[model samples]
Target: MKRKIAPFILIALSLIIAVGLSACSESGRNVEEIRIGVTGPLTGATANSGVASKQGMELAVDEWNEKGGIEVEGNKLPIKMYFEDNQGKPDQGVSTAEKLFNNEEVDFLIGDAFASSVTMAIMDLAGQYEKPILSGEPVSSAISDKITENPDKYKYFWKGNVGSDAYGDSVYQTVKMLEESGDFQPTDKTVSFVVEDTDYGRSNADEVARLLENDGWKVVAYETVEVGHTEFYPQLTKLGSLKPDLLVSVFTADSSGVALVKQINETKLKTLHTAVYYPTRPEFIENAKDSSEGLVWIPLMFEPLLRESQVDFATAIKEKWNVVATPNHALGYDTMNNALTSIAEAQSLDSEKIVEQLAKLDRDGILGRFVFDDSNHTIKAGPEYIPVPAVQIQDGKNAIIWPENISTSKYQK
Candidate 1:
């Protein structure tokens, strides 16, 4: 049995070994780290939200790596995170998504954490090549609609947050309960919208409008602006002239919100102003502190100092990054950990198995419990799951004024 192998046979065996190693992954992950391509509005428009999300994601990855990463089969792997900014642009999101996939060779993607327009830009890339994709904060129901429309086609896509439709429920119920309880009085049952032009803004505005209309409230005006557009004087002027009893606005860019609130101060409209999304951002509070007073908004689920645990967590983040953590940060942290937990459940890097575990995931996060409905590939929303409570900005603080059981304070005129 000591016969020597031919040179040609030895060369053939070497080639087979190389091919097997190369075929181990779409991206070369046989050694070193598991790469996650992180994308967000890191530099423009909703940059604050983007930065907050990135920090939370980094913290999660750092903690995971500290634990020696999730064991896959028998070996432990560490995670390496790298970010690309989408600038809140849809085209930019699509391009960076490709760069993450074909160039950086990322095994997973957490992306466009700023707005639905940006998230949807790259959402389908996962299904295109069968890679797992997770998104944070972009809650437009259209994303869920797309997934449900072709569940098999987009089996790899998962949304970390509940749909924008939940916001409709939150806004309508908050208003109705307050009215019925005599906590709020309305001279005129009219409302209007000033939302960003993107799908996230339009979708939420539409939902809020439909619900308000069902309650016999007239929708007087609906205005849309570009993502970073700050000139809200015309809209404010119109709202002042019309004198709608309520004005509901949505924006992702903190600048837009700051501008709108400041202008609202100048216009001095008497509407019970209710905002969406932006007020949760630190920049909005800092830039428009006086104007944000009495501004009602939804889903105050992750105020940095809302709880003692949040205070400790925020302190840690501040010491590390010198930035204030917000609800957006918590959302990012939860999204990352939830995805990792599913990967651990799968016990392998196989995309199909990971998606399988994702569909079955039921876990608690800083925000609340996360349970995805495979029918829509989104987290469920309700008081039992995730509460979308409305809050009024009262003297540099958020006061929960709706849903009597959890109301921290009664509505202030």
Candidate 2:
């Protein structure tokens, strides 16, 4: 009996020692790898937005990691990111969100920048999982609007950038500026709106049309094209017959805008060339060339006069990734920075606690002064994402061509 008892005691002691060693080993693993989940389109038409956002997140992650990562509960852990491709589709976004929540178990989520509809679709799941999600680049006011409209439905979702109202506001200012300049008369009062039929396009176009109509401007034509509509002759011809004063083209891809530019030029539409989205960048030079000269549009960011911090960061990212960062990158890096700041201040890894810290976030970045407003979002601000420079396509490239207050007017001289 004594022998059996002794053997049992030794076995129990060994088991206890083994358990303790396992606990220590688990703790020894890098605590800094606070897994952040990233979702966006890496391929497809809107790949630019997703890829740009991913690069931005990587850039921020690299910077933070080099700086010793975040401190949480007396432990320092490096931030490790997990990514999934949503292919710029709403259904895909939902699945991506689910995978992040269930499988990856990311500490936080960011991305799906271009898919406004997709962002809205996954808002509920984010709430269910109690995981804080920083919106990557979706610009529809609807993201925070829907969340705040029904907080019970979505309490974990927040945005790090402004929305499409920037487009409408800039348009209003540009039109107003043009009117004041006396270069264009108020008689050119008819405005036409065109967009891809996606959620982002439709929502943005609706807001633009609404704002213009409220400003007492006549909407000469309001048209929606299917996502991949290649032929714009029908829409352009129909709009031409109406004789709008300015054509507001709101397509997604460079090819789409290029197609419209070529078609309109060939047809000799007499309307002023005004648009949002692509055809306002250097790429506009490749597609529309001289025809794009004097084309007016609202863009997310102007690369030339970027802040020193932004320029340095952009240069580093380009050197590392061999790709230029866009506004999407700014949003991603800001989101990561905000997350790290929250984790450091809170000193905990809990997601709900992070939400409280995020709401109080007030930090400036490459994008601009970021203060998530009552809408629980931040970005360039006034009428158009306030303070965002309204750029015009000039000499085959985007040149500051108006409201010198927001724009640097580098091309003014």
Candidate 3:
């Protein structure tokens, strides 16, 4: 009887030790690591914008980590970023998103520069997975239209920048201001427009043209160019023949803008040249050089008009990356920081809860005060927040020329 009791006691002791070790291993698991997935055209013609955006996100994450990361529900979780190169293609964008959602299991997502096609392609996946996606710079109205049409289906998607209509109106307002100020006077009040075939370029061009016509400006020439068309002399020469007062080229690709500006100078097109978005990039100034001079553009974020906190953030970017932060960078940084803010406010890692907090967020930061319109989930463009400044390239540098309060220089013909 003693021997049987001894064997049973030994078995019971072994079981207790095994259970204790299992509990220790379970408690040791890492639950303080939050994953964020980012996608962009990291290795294509639009790489400059993509790289800038990625750098901005990295900087924001670094800053958060330096402060011991974000605290949620009593846990200070460190952020880990994972990036996927979408190459600015719709198919690739979808695939990259799948990898981030399934393989990496990221808690949040961001990115895709300038291309609305990529942004639209990923909306379904974002909705299905219930992940909140903050778009970096895809400013097409189609994004908002879809959201407005079916809010329940695409509730997780949010835009980081103002819509193309806002940009178009700002451009029109700048020209009107110039005319009123007597800085620019065209005898015929005639205009010509050129746009890339992409959704971004065409949509902005259409809006600008519509606004110009409503303002009594005649649109004599309207043309569209393929995305990578290198030579614009044929188009510019034809438009020059029309002898319009203003020649506008709405471009999304950097190389196309550079090439078009070079051709515009070579052809000696006397009409004033204006572009959107692309001209704010450093590559535009570097590649176009003197040709880029006198060109007018609408920058989503103008550095000179930024708040002190934004200025400080820009300085930090310059110091760390050895590059001047463009509007694209600001968009990237602002979107990430906004997401972080939402996470902190929610105090939970659930994506839906974060979305709820985002809808209610109305705070100022790098990109100005961000208040999302509940109907479409986009920030309204205004001087108070997300001012679309009409900037002109004077002496190969960006100078704010509109909204007198922030104008660094008067508009010059």
Candidate 4:
């Protein structure tokens, strides 16, 4: 569904345009390059995510530059990147955004941290400063809810990803389908959750739990841990004791995900295991290998083994960066491409035109089609827009198992 922009959102758009005009860089100036400031955890626990995002952004930049750059006012302006390391800290994210605005004077910004805490920290900079921001990851529903609740406050912000609820829906439907197909049977209708202690983690955990509870499943245990906390033994031990039929883990760190898999095996927590976010990274399989066998996860977008388009994008990324591409890389690539497409379509740096063009965009990327729900300035999720399929790691490869029409393999446990 498309968003019906309220009057306040229009007013907010006007404010963004007015601010953009006063900012000079987004106005009639001798602009040689489109300065884009990028934020990612380039040097912390999630450095792999940061690096992948950087590579994706670079790929997008190369594509636009190869096309002779974005034409505006008879001048082709190339994109120049100003990437900063947030280290996955909220404070660092805020400070990094400030630096980008004050020092680089970037015409646009992209957030790649994929964490709600970090995205929320830097969201206001779009309005407070004179630029518009688009984010690729960070799936917490709270971000969209906030924009919906206070449109005027977030008028200059846009999210290129679907909300956390999509993850919940994917996991819930996966479990339900597995049961319906007689591939999964439970002694008791019980579910457990272990997630990072952040909005993204807690939000996904609560959403999936809510769906299962509504379906008559009892909640056995709900555990939260700090980001990068690898000590799942305590939580795994508790889960083993309870023996919930399903255990869902949500985290963003590669180490945390790999550690969870290894420890779950060590603890022999036999409950059917599912996950969100982390397992999509290639390092998870490289690091976890056999331990991740039969693990079901959601939201597979850029698995090279899944689609020819995926393989094409992964091949380009490998040729460019010498590293295997992950779903996060696809997200970052699509996010940047969406921004550039809108900017070029607008033909001017006017925030009003760019934002309008963005809301009307209907394009395809490595993930799937890109269409925003104008109601809340977030991407639509599902089969028709973006398919959020459930996947299982079998023999160190991605085997899509749920959403049967797109399933390449059946669920094996």
Candidate 5:
């Protein structure tokens, strides 16, 4: 009986030891793969911008993988991207977010680059799952406001580009500069807005109208169009009838922007056509053809007038993709690079830890020096950080025309 009891005790001890060793191994295991999920309008009206952003993110990921990937806890972890097309719809965006978080089990997430409505729809999921989102190009100020209102609830959301208010202010500044330079003068001192009927477009148009009204410019006509609306002749005709000094368009769809610009040009409207965020794409020029000429656009960053460091990145993207990099592309590259840096700083793959490091990250890249505002979780927009670059289409080329220091050409009518 004593011998039997002794054998049983020894077996029990061995089992305990094995369990301890297994736990230790699991705790110290190195991350093998870092999964990143991306959502965008890859197959809808805004597919051009979404595709460009994906290319930029892919370029950054490829570069890191070529360099043996990101190092974590003395082990190199390769990046794996899982891309989902939101198709520029709010419901689809939420579903895509759920798939990335639940099915794919991605460690990080990026994008929803084309539509602000889609970005806003996914914020609830980001908060619920505690996954950090480095948004690519969604510019609605509502996102920042939500984060600011509830820091803990929406701390995971960070804007990768300027907010709508900043964009509006930038457009205002350009108009003021033009006014001062005697390039633009209206007998009526009036302006009109033709905006997409979405959170992004409406918010930006409201901000621009507010600023213009404050500056003593009368807003003559304000019209809203659906997201994928192609026929803009009615809106353009109404705006033309107003005979305002300037026509500000806030369209996310490249097709809409081209059609509107072409119609405005063909109708010979005297109002100066300026857009917020749409005309920065190379496809805009290709689609609009000569109609895009003389159109001014407020871009988050202008690729042609990028800083030296940014120029290198632009060159790399152009060579690899055989297409010019737009502001969306720059935002994508910067967002991914920033995420990689934050992961390294956190020294762990845990989502919460990555969020902690991201809150404190302040670095410079293609989009210039970036530091998220503590309250809003958005990159501060000013001269010192990510200032808006106003680009104008001149002779079938997009050229910087504002912030004189970076201007490649004067404002062309």
Candidate 6:
């Protein structure tokens, strides 16, 4: 009878061991299951930019996860991202944020490539949920500062790119450098700024105006009109009277750029200087045909070989994507990388700690040495413009005309 009781006790102990082993297996799985959330205009007017950004994010994540993800303490984890299409609408973006915060339970967040207005709608939500949001492409200065205004409500958001005001400041530097180099007369001071009637346009126009005034330059004219104004001749007529030495037009897409250049060429403004954003693209030059000649634009970044590292990166990215990578792609890559690195450093799934680590980063990644300012979560990498050479359309090609080292093909004058 004693032997029978001893056998029953051994069977019970075996069952308990089995249950404990199963629990351990479920609780200690690999860290690759970390989830990140991403939102963007994947199916709307800004779809091209969205697609490029998505690709950059996926590329970085794929590479990182392949390397066993980032190391936290003694364990390596894997990262998985869940992306939602915002359709480039504020309402859609808000819905996506809701899903990410409530249902998906993502460890981190990214994007809203347009501006602060789009980011603002979802920033508070991220903060309320205590989830870190590493911005992908919004350039407005307010994206970061808004958080500082309401620290309790927006403590989890951080910027991983430059602000919109930086571009205007860079343009100012370009103008000053050109004048000092004797490329233009110091009296070539009359400047005209024409912007489309949009939030981005308004902010850009104001910044440019303020910058020019601060620099003691004569602002010949400052104007804003609806984006789809096909006929720019009326405005061109007014600008012509101002006798501006420089014409700075910020238009979007191929159609608007072509229309602007056609109006400029037909009006015969004889301004001797013209600069525009969309017109700098290859498609814009092709659409403008001969009218694109002699247009000087300042690009935030370009794909041409300005330096060894840049040339290599541009060639590699272009070969992979079959098109030039815009600054949007750079922002996307940096944002995702920063978010993932923050996750590794935090060593926990808590968003509050991740945000803190991101704000303290001093690492140099694809977008160069960058660190988000603690005061406002703004990334400061110094004002480094790509120095968009004075490229002119000549003999069926856009050729550079400034800085002897980068002048590959001279303009056919």
Tens digits of per-residue lDDT, candidate 1, 188-306, equal: 79888999999899999999998988888998899999887888888888778888888888888878889999988887777778888888787777789799888889878877555
Clashes in model 6: which pairs? Answer: 31-78, 32-78
> lDDT, candidate 3, residue 255?
89
lDDT of each: 0.84, 0.72, 0.81, 0.86, 0.82, 0.68
Task: Report the lDDT of model 6 for residue 47.
Answer: 66
What tens digits encode model 5's per-residue C-alpha lDDT throughout 56-102? 88888998899898877678889888889999899999899889877
Identify the runs in model 3 with alpha carbons over 4 angstroms from their true place. Answer: 1-31, 304-309
* Model 5 CA lDDT for position 32: 78
Winning candidate number (lDDT): 4
Ten residues in sequence with the least summed lDDT for candidate 3: 300-309
Count the clashes in each prediction.
0, 12, 0, 2, 0, 2
Show model 1 residue runs off by greater than 4 Å: 1-29
TM per candidate comes to 0.91, 0.86, 0.88, 0.91, 0.88, 0.77
Let me know the TM-score candidate 6 reaches against the reference structure. 0.77
Model 6, 1-413: lDDT tens per residue? 99989988999998999898778644544445788888887875456667777777777788798797876665677788888889766778888988876677677888565444567677777666777887776656667668668767777888766665665665665566566667666455778877766555556556666787787777878777655456788889998787787777765444667888888889998664545446545567677887877666544344444434556545556776777866556657767887887887888777777877887787665556667777777776353322334455555455555544556654342
The runs of at least 3 residues in candidate 5 whose Cα sits more than 4 Å from the true structure, single-residue gaps closed, are 1-31, 305-308
Ten contiguous residues with the weakest lDDT in model 1:
24-33
